[model samples]
Target: MQNIQHPMFALSLIFSFILVTHAFLYFISSLFSNSNYWFYFLAQECILFISAFILPNGSPTVLIGLLPVLIAQSIIILKNKLKVILFFMLSYGLYCIAITINYGASELPIFIPIFFLILLIVIVYTISYNRQVSARERMEFYLQQLELAYQKVEELTLSNERQRMARDLHDTLAQGLAGLIMQLEAVNVHIKNGNISRSNEIIVSSMQQARETLKDARTVIDNLRTETLEYMDFHSAVLDEIKKFEEITGIDVEQEIKPIHSLSNLSMEYGIYIIRESLTNIMKHSQARKVKIKIEQKDGKIYMEVSDNGIGFSIKNIGKQTGKFGLLGLQERIRLVGGGLTIESMPGKGTKLFITVPI
Candidate 1:
């Protein structure tokens, strides 16, 4: 309806480029390093304020366009709702001031609707972005907890092994050596007293005991060097877990495994752990009568799904469910091996777990 070339439109073009370019560069650089976004924010507001005077009233609203950019910038750094609202109000105030100075108080009526429209966009975007950020933060917190739990599990395993070794050594090698020494001392006493037959008998008895102790030591060493699932890969491991789970719980399990032969040891370990934990949760929390498990390898990734027909709960209330699936260590476990996990469920509905990991 209105098309007149103005200085303001040309000036606003520069403002748009700077704002978009800075945001792009900031996003990319942020992946490598933190940036001083404050400078970008100040520069944008300054440019938009300047454009209001050079451009005619009929030109595009350069000042109003800057509103969303400001909110986007704030979302990256600030989480406090009050702080976001304050920044929004402050920027809007400065914009209103610029308009008042450039166009006069009587022109306010023309800008009111656009101001409310921008506010709606900012509010909706802020709330949505805030929810996404909160979800990510919670996932991160769960990963940290999983890491800590893994460390504790490893430490406890090592400590337990050391204690077992110590106990075995005392019971086997140490006792054998002490008994040999006592028997030799007795033989010496008998030999000194000229009792050759008694000395020979004692020597033969000590030889037999030494052989038994050596056998016990070898058995312990073998156990220490091997794990229960050392040779089997991830796919077999999941089936094994399901087999055990069904046997113990009396709940029939349905499993589909596409053997993942190329999985790294780390990936397999994490996969088995996830299956184990999932089964544990099922046994403990889910009052389900049946379970289904699926595993497959596709496109250089391992995918797993475990579902059960149990009374389920809301994913929205995950934070409140202290010992539930999402809040627990499965996400963290899957995450450590450079993978992701997703769960779907609802009230009176079954829960399904989807797992993906690089092979």
Candidate 2:
């Protein structure tokens, strides 16, 4: 206490306070702001020795404050447990040695050892608390991620179920309903023409169709269902389809499209339908030698056109064709997704489809 009152001890206190403040702040900077702290700690430790030796007379006041600050600093900045332990031990040893030399070892207070033991307890408790907090936070984060992954898997399962139901309905019930309606329609036409025998025949055929529809529906439900197709990139799938068409029909296809890697899954699905429908129609009705396909994005929308150089038919009679379902369905799908489809054709000319769909 007398040494602390001396002018030289006051100077030593100022230097030690400034150095500790800087090191502690830099150590804080490293923890909260991700900065370098080891250099500051090293420099502070060297200066700390200087300050400790300057107070040759026992100054328990400085050691009491400085020891705790060193422990706190080591805890905040040091990553290695061994280094933290060694730093505390070495600092405490130096403090005891300085105090013992200044005050005769025989005159040291009995409670001084007890005071040091309490500090060691606090340091140990602090390290244990820090590790527990870190482990708990990590466990919470892992649980959150697991919950998210479970939700995604559940969503995928529901989506798959819906797709399967849709395919079953479309393949069996839908086709049966279409045949029954067409039969009923034909029966009406025949009854008006006073042909009773033909009308009865259509009614009998309609009943047969209903039975077949039931069997098909059961077959689809009983069998193990799988995905319609494996997932593939839209552009690559389109290219494969075109190549297959060329191989089958001997018709050369001229494709002109920009990079389509950014198209959404829904957009790509519709694109596939449009391509297949347009190409099938060309193969069926158009006696064309060459066909052109183009796709691009413009005005924040997707534009697609399929054209063929062949003898085109009258658009008005398209409805009369029994297989006009494909083209009509294509148009409906495109329109439902905020898109428009236009057909251009005339007798002895080419047919072209202009389409616009939002992104």
Candidate 3:
């Protein structure tokens, strides 16, 4: 159907063009045979034809000049083509006869003006078309650049997510498995020493540790399944971590968190993870009796403090310990989100970690 309609439209356009051409020819014939009107009509027709060849799209100046030709044709035709054609032929023969009788003795200079007009039309049309084409090409180039920039942003986002997952695994599940493995190895050595009862107890403890390690690993994976951090409530997620910490270490835990109405998930999740990892390090290394966790908002920023009343180590000695990735990962996470983490402790005094993240 579209193909048929397209041909019909093309035919209509062709018919319109033929009608216009016929009208122009008849109007030219109606002008005077020996007067200035005949010369004027011929001159205007020359301009229109040159414009069509040069501009391709007719100019307003050219159309204005062509108007007299159109009017003369209309007067001769009287809306009937047969009569108009007979009168047109008679008028043309008379015009040629008058020209031969009046100006046959000399060469006319009329063609000079027509030649310059045509040249001007061609130059202006070529410049305008080239400029329009260049403008369109420039617009397309900018659009392609914008598309590439958006793609790069998407790729960087995916890369950051993968790095976060790796850091989480290294800090939580990987460390848990290492501890469990060490306990199992100790049990095996005890069995080789011929201490049957102690070996049995060590075996039982190692099994329990393995079970806990597997459960923690599963929790990490489950949490990762949620693409957006907003899927979990900040307070509830923090409490879950506290519960896990208490279950694993038998430490008394206390938490005080202030409500934030319009907290962004990115800031909240990162803050919670930082606090969780800090507490995990404390539980595994510090022989503390009680732990206090506090979260508060002030001046458009979230501040968290996790401190334990345990045998503390020097902050300067962090890199010296082999099991210090947890602290390093916490630092990296805080840095990723434009936040800061600070650790303060002495050899016998307790350790205190203060983290501040802007929302």
Best by TM-score: 1
For 1-359, candidate 2 gives per-residue lDDT tens digits of 55445667576677568657756665566454334455555565655565655664435555665566667667866767887788777776666666777676764575367547767777787788888988999999999999888767745754675577668867788889998999999999999999999999999999999999987885465322223223676667667668878997998899987766556555665666677768878887788998999988888788889999889878897667867526777788798678999989888898899988776
lDDT of 1 by residue, 1-359 (tens): 12244345555676557557655754664444235555555555665655556454632366667566666667656656686677777677777787788788787788867877886787688778878989999999999999899768755764575578667867887888889899999999999999999999999998898898887886565334325455776656677778878887999898777767766555566677788878878888789998998888899998889899998778787767687763357877787778988889898998898989887
My TM-score estimates for the predictions, one after another, are 0.54, 0.43, 0.44
lDDT of 3 by residue, 1-359 (tens): 32353445564455446447645655665554534544544554443444433332222233333333343443433435664355445433433333334445242244224433654565366456657878999999999999788668745664576578767867777787787778778878888888789878877887887787777666566446335455777777778788888898888798898875566556666766786778778877888999999998898888889998889888887767767536877888899888888888998899899889887
Candidate 1: which pairs clash? 8-55
* Candidate models: Cα lDDT each: 0.73, 0.72, 0.65
Error of 2 at 65 (Å): 27
- Rank by TM-score, descending? 1, 3, 2
Point out the worst 10-residue segment of candidate 2 by lDDT: 221-230
lDDT accuracy of residue 232 in candidate 3: 71
Give stretches of model 3 more than 4 Å off. Answer: 1-216, 222-228
